[model samples]
Target: MPEFNAPLRDMRFVLHQVFQGPALWARLPALAGTVDADTADAILEEAAKITGQLLAPLNRSGDEQGVTFAAGEVRTPDGFKQAWQTFREGGWVGLAGNPEHGGMGMPKMLAVQFEEMLYAANCSFSLYSALSAGCCLAIDAHASEALKAIYLPQLYSGQWGGTMCLTEPHAGTDLGIIRSKAEPYADGSYRVSGTKIFITGGEQDLTENIIHLVLAKLPDAPAGPKGISLFLVPKYLVNADGSLGERNAASCGSLEHKMGIKASATCVMNFDGATGYLVGEPNKGLAAMFTMMNYERLSIGIQGIGCAEASYQNAARYARDRLQSRAPTGAQAREKPADPIIVHPDVRRMLLTMRALTEGGRAFATYVGLQLDTAKYAEDPDERDAAQRLVALLTPVAKAFFTDTGLESCVLGQQVFGGHGYIREWGQEQLVRDVRIAQIYEGTNGIQALDLLGRKVVADGGQSLKLFAAQIRSFCASEPPYADAVLHALGQLESLSQWLGERASSDANAIGAASVEYLQLFGYVAYAYMWSRMAAVAKAQRKQEPDFHDAKLGTAAFYFERLLPRILSLEASIRAGSSSLFQLSAEQF
Candidate 1:
């Protein structure tokens, strides 16, 4: 595997310099006094150590020997169990969880960086903890206090792991079609009977207990998504005194053989009348499940970013070491038979594209994290509400755009390696394979685009989009050096949003046809906005941190000159409308 190194300097720049996360934390009552720049830096530094040293070494080895399953149980690859223990003992699982429930209560702003490191180091191992974090979020938000008292501590402490059970054999995207049934029991628990597939970490040996947050339907429930209900089905039943009891009826039927992230166990779960406890109000499961889904979407987006970062690290290192050709003008390394590949203009372009996207993405993801923190921790109600609205509007964009660009960046990274990239030993191929799932899972990029364009943007009468536009306008109003460029891109995005909104109203298929392109356009514009912000900060800090700020400005220039031009093509496609998409008949072939 390519040597994995966490980009701590860039991560710090995004958090403390571009976003001023510590400043934001100082104001939020929930984070005030608990978190500071020094504290956050120390934590991230330790995370970098663990990810780069412990987890990364096992990445290629784990992939070579995927999970093994037999006799209704699954075992992870060698060293995963110990690495997971190290991860748990470090108090990472509950980093963003409630402190009152044995959690660290870290802000999302910091948690996101830690997440990126985990993914970049080893995505397969990261999923186990990632799902656990999402499960903790949903349970903390909606689960009963008694339930919290019993499960929260165990989950956060890593005595148990978590998984979300939604997809079944017959239904993947359509949760309403699920056949999982939950029958009421006189003892206040329900009997859950159904099977779920593609369940990550559904059955693993890393933790002693596994908690599955399942979606099911009640006997007298309404039709469609409204009929769904969320349940907490444990692997081992918890006794009245919080001790382990007999095993539950739930068991792993089989493990999924997948294209990538092979080290992570994707199980086929069968619940034969398993005991379950309802988390929220009856018939409100869809809404509750979303709490976890949204969290996973963002994390999966980070998964893409993580892979891109890893790819860039390996590619950049290879470019500097591989001797290929001399520079156009002169030989940088005259003593050598040929100059390093980095001397070639085309390779430099590829490397710059990878750097520009990865850095811009880090800033963009941190911005979203800040919005989440504002929504969850801000003191004022109106501020929280506004932040929540922005989070809702941008979640799909972040999820889809990051993954799309991440995949693009990975391909470019592979290109830098040429023939070496095609082989398994170089590790670039694994990145391409691993990151591909990010685009497919979590409701797929196409589904995310539709959610952004049709549901989030169009269904709300463009209200959420307007909120976002207003934010970009406010930022541009600050009058930075690149304010004009930021303003122009924002203007283009706003105009396109209006154009798409009006066109969709007249043509029902307009949104669906234009969604993917619109999302790419929005993503490019969003990255441009982030680049502008970073450039402004870099320009101001140039005197203090000359090299770092100069590099930031150079990357910002590359993004503006080379990458931002992508929006032009995307805009044209969006305006091309739905006519071409539906022209082909189903039986034409």
Candidate 2:
């Protein structure tokens, strides 16, 4: 079996040396005294232990046994319930939750590292906690005080699990067409009747109760998405005194047998006249749900990074130990029958590509986490607004780009093992199977790309893209390592943004036609910016930690030399416009 040890040193480098997370935390009053470098390190270490020791052992077994459903009850695989108890006891579910609600109140900058570790150790196990965290975030952001007081504590404590129920059989991406209905009652609650599909952890044996955030349309509302509303519906109703009352009408009809992450119960949740309280205003449910979706989008992106990291570790180790053929020039291991595959140029290319993308993605995810912290905790209004805008602009890229390259890296890692990678015991195949879903879920990568190009970039007339470009330009002014290359990439992005804006004005289908490529181009440039920053930091600190920092410098060079140029072809594809795409009609196929 493959092994997973949290890359603590690299994580520390990103958190401390590359991003200076502690200094930024100190600047934000909400996070000033909450955590420091030592505290963050301790938290990360504990998280590593729990994930690497407890959860990782269950990853392969969990995938094999999967979840079982009987008599309308969903049971997780063996050892998961015990692991959940330990995980909850550690208060990890609410690592970044609000302090007032019994949470530890850690900044996202730190919580992101823990999340990566969770998914790396076990993606299936990680989804349970990830959903709960996202559900808590949405409720805390938009729920009433009474609702928060009643639900937040239990959800944060992990006594109860949480899920976001948005997709229905008839509605997946176009939520406006959903048929779920919410009927108002005299007692100020609504009777929610909806059949939501693909609900993660909707009905699980790991927790006492499951809190579901459902989306439905009210009776007297306008048509389309404006008619939608968000409701807090639980599996078991809670009495005024906070004890569990009779079972609500919500029940799991069945669990979807999926290709990967099989341990996670992808449930068909049937809410039959379930008692639900409105969260936030009616006709604004999508807005409230976006609070959770954005969080999940980023979380799913980390899922990609986690899987890639795990795959890279196993592949790198396997290459070093598995001897295949003698080196072209000479045998480095004369005592052995043949030199290790690591001596081969092709193997080196695959391993280096994996390392470069995984490390660059880590830096990029951390950067987004820092923006989340700044957006929420910054004292200055202008600063907070800027950070929030950056969050909006970069989120889709983070989601799509990370997963796109994440899958690429995993495939490369699998290829490193040749036929062994195709088998189940080695665990490379599992990583590939598990990470594939990241690209499909959380508003498929295609939707994410269109969101980036149509909504975030072109919708704003390139203003948001310019805001990002300005930051890169500001960094380029300092002339750090790879600054010239980064600046040139930034220029290409700017020119492309302008070109896209012009095309969008002239052609309605231009954005959709070019969205996926546009997002890929943006992703490459964004990672280039991250690699540039990491290179500068590693170059300056190479004397202190030669092995670590030198490796970073080497990877940064690899990214700039090999991966960064992918944007050139993406740029050309975007410039090609929608004409070729439209040439084929619906009848052509």
TM-score of each: 0.99, 0.99
| Lowest lDDT 10-residue stretch of candidate 1 | 480-489
Clashes of each: 0, 0
Q: 535 in model 2: Cα distance from truth in Å? A: 0.8
Q: Which residue runs of candidate 1 sit more than 4 Å off their true CA positions? A: none
* Candidate 2 lDDT (Cα, 0 to 1): 0.94
lDDT of 1 at 521: 86
Candidate 2: list runs displaced more than 4 Å.
none
lDDT of 2 by residue, 1-589 (tens): 8778999999999999889999999888888889999999999999989989999999999999999999999999999999999999999999999999988999998888898999899999999999999999999999999999999999999999999999999899999999999999999999999899999999999999999999999998899999999999999999999999999999999999999999999999999999999999999999999999999999999999999999999999999999998999899999999999999999999999999989988999999999999999999999999999999999999999889988999999999999999999999999999999999999999999999999999888888888888999898899999999999998898899888899888899899989999899898899899999999998998899999888998888988998899989999898998899878789997
TM-score of 2: 0.99
Evaluate model 1: give its TM-score: 0.99
Worst 10 residues of 2 by lDDT: 458-467
